[model samples]
Target: MALVCFGIDKFPDHCNFVNGGDGSVSTQTVEKTSTNRKLAPRYRVLLHNDDYNPMEYVVQVLMSTVPGLTQPQAVSIMMEAHTNGLALVITCALEHAEFYCETLKNHGLTSTIEPDE
Candidate 1:
């Protein structure tokens, strides 16, 4: 793509400059659009199992740190971590993921977050 820009404007990305044949400067409006709405990048909160914290405590933390997590779901996540050494606690936006990860850490649990592929 080739572009010839004149001066910096408020809407630099959406405007183009062109020289008119009559020696006049004209501004062309080129709308930038996206066919699909951009989705927020998601992050994965991971729980790493250890021999220190008790299984029941882990389940409780999972349920308390993340809202709307039922007991069965918490148990499943805890059991997965216990059996597999690691488990995905939740997939959400960065702020929520960070909050959840920090909350889990505050509760004496090993947790981390990574970009969800």
Candidate 2:
């Protein structure tokens, strides 16, 4: 008579077992079952105020470079940058924030990304 069992570490007692005709026992222990998963760090995309680019151009760039950014949102960001010297355009994954910042830079706008805290 043999018994084989398989179970996750989180629930050691909760197992599925099978009986073998021979007198042997086997058990499969599931490795660490983590409840918490690490998430990728987020970043903030910022647009800096610059004298070179026009307000309308800034708005256009904001609208086009960042996904889901509406015209009204773009205008608001541009205005904020104009008044405050900088404005947060978006908060997203590092890669996306970098891409957006670079795209804005390509259009002659000052942009930067920083880890979201």
lDDT tens readout by residue for model 1, 1-117: 234574566657667867776677777888767889789999999999999998888988898899999999999999999999999999999999999999999999999999999
* lDDT tens digits by residue: candidate 2, 23-93: 54455444556689789999999999988888888888888898889999999999999999989999999
Instruction: For model 2, give the RMSD to the true fold.
Output: 4.6
Count backbone clashes in candidate 2: 0
* Model 1 ranges with Cα > 4 A deviation: 1-36
**Alpha-carbon RMSD, candidate 1:** 7.1
Predicted structure 1, TM vs. truth: 0.70
Which candidate ranks first by lDDT, i.e. highest?
1
The 10-residue segment with the lowest total lDDT in model 2: 2-11
Model 2: lDDT equals 0.84
How many backbone clashes are present in model 1? Answer: 0
